[model samples]
Target: MEIAVVTGGVAEIERDAGQGSSMEAEWLALLAALRLARRQGLADFVLLGDAAAVVAQANGAVRAPGAMAAHLSAFFVLASDGPAPRVRHIKRTQNLAGIALARGR
Candidate 1:
């Protein structure tokens, strides 16, 4: 899987998701993005993704599957360190990270 983080229409992070299912890759991407934001000391930011289920899980709108529970927990722990970033779902066409990954392909 290809994962990417885009800021200001530029790719800030991009790499291959070594080995995982699509769902796992999505969670990994989100975790990586949050880690980057925290490292950069970003206080206010929103994470946008095309994965609705993942977004819902992150926002507490729906329960994550058992397979993803650990990922959900890790996400919460990282988010709790500072201002929790909002995770929102957007259309695939509007997802910059997705677009970046597509372009790279």
Candidate 2:
């Protein structure tokens, strides 16, 4: 099975927004990685996030359980046979591309 690593990067705003969480951006970033892999016809892939929470969410960790949990669980089950992909976590320093994308630089 072909494996792809979907990685994300994170940065703190020196000038804090203080209200809206940047989680949406991170979420979009995860989607971006997933989309890229899909475009390449790669079904088996892993998602790596800067934070452990993101990784666990993608990998179906047992914390903060919700619809995402159920979705990921189901996705993994189906993908296991239908070109399964894996999701994991990586440090921000390790995700250079994602960092750049996040920074919009």
Candidate 3:
């Protein structure tokens, strides 16, 4: 899987994700981006992704399935370490990270 991060409309990180289900990959990408933001000392930022289910689960709008429960928990724990996390769902075309990944392919 391909994972990418874009900040301020610029590509900040891109990487190949190891083997996992699509849901797991989405969670991994979100986690990776949050970790990077924390390292950069960012206190306020919004995370945008094309995965609607992951975003909904992250925002507590829905409950994650059993396989994704741990990931949802981990996201909350990591997000609590800094400012409140704002995760939003966007169309694939509106996601820069998705665009970048497409270009890489």
Candidate 4:
């Protein structure tokens, strides 16, 4: 999975070994991004990605099912433990930088 943290319009890319579907990778990336932001002393952040389902789950629109349920639960706990976080979905073309990084993975 590839995660990009955009703080002040500048982005830093990070990657992890992705398992399962694209949505899973996106969810994992969201978790990782939030953790990274907290480590950087960020008190509030927004996560932008191209995965619709994952974004929906993060935004509490859809239920996280199967293996993702645990991750989703963990996401909420970690998020509330520190900074305020927002997750958003964007078009793949608009997320080209992350797309390239994910493809390389």
Candidate 5:
């Protein structure tokens, strides 16, 4: 699993294959991004990612699967008990930069 948190063009990334599933990783990454932003005193932020299921769950547009339900719940708690850092899903083609960064290429 690889996660990137970008703010002002500066990106902070974390990778953990130790985590079981991609959905879990996405949820964890989203939670970590929000926590990082809040700890850095960043407000009114936007979170972009390539995971549609995770985005929908985070945005309350759909229910999270059992594997990621708890992870999503945790994100909501950190996001002021609701959505924060507005999440948007992008096409994988449009996410080349993030993919390259994640691959360290």
Candidate 6:
């Protein structure tokens, strides 16, 4: 899982690969950000992810599957008005904290 906390152009990203396993851990991070952004009433924010799910969810064009599907389904219950969160695919080297977190997890 990877997280990029940003207020403006500046952001600090934290990441970890849980069990040092598959990339699914990264998806969890995206899910966490989606949940957080929705809770924060964020009409717009920047998100970093290696998967397309972040972009798809923000655009309301794709739905999460498996265990994450349920939470993602509930998340959209709120009004996600305004532009969707900006999603940029970042390299692992740029997502330090996220990489670390995924590993730790």
CA lDDT scores, all candidates in order = 0.87, 0.51, 0.86, 0.75, 0.75, 0.55
Over the stretch 1-105, how does candidate 5's per-residue lDDT look in tens digits? 776666666667776536567677777777877887788787677777788998999999999878788887788788884445698999876664366565684
Task: List residue ranges in candidate 1 displaced over 4 A.
Answer: none
Please name the candidate that would achieve the greatest lDDT relative to the true structure.
1
Put the candidates in lDDT order, highest first.
1, 3, 4, 5, 6, 2
Report the alpha-carbon TM-score of model 5 versus the true structure.
0.81
Q: Tell me which of candidates 1 and 2 scores higher on TM-score.
A: 1
Q: Which residue runs of candidate 3 sit more than 4 Å off their true CA positions?
A: 12-15
Error of 4 at 98 (Å): 2.0
In lDDT terms, how accurate is model 5? 0.75
What shift in Å separates residue 69 of candidate 5 from its native position after superposition? Answer: 0.7
| Cα RMSD to the true fold for all candidates | 1.3, 8.2, 1.5, 2.8, 2.5, 5.2
Better of 3 and 6 by lDDT: 3
Q: Which window of 10 residues has the lowest lDDT sum in candidate 5? A: 96-105
Per-model TM-score on C-alpha atoms: 0.92, 0.54, 0.90, 0.77, 0.81, 0.47
Give lDDT: candidate 5, residue 56: 94
Instruction: Tell me the tens digit of each residue's lDDT in model 2 across 2-95.
Output: 1123333333222322333344344445555565666667655675677566566666555434534544554454445445456667787877
Comparison by lDDT, 4 against 5, better one = 4
> lDDT value for candidate 4?
0.75
Off by over 4 Å in 2: 1-20, 63-82, 102-105
For model 4, give the 10-residue run with minimal summed lDDT: 1-10
Best by TM-score: 1
Between 3 and 4, whose TM-score is larger? Answer: 3
Cα lDDT tens digits, model 1, 2-58, are 688875566865475687788988898899889988988999999988999999999
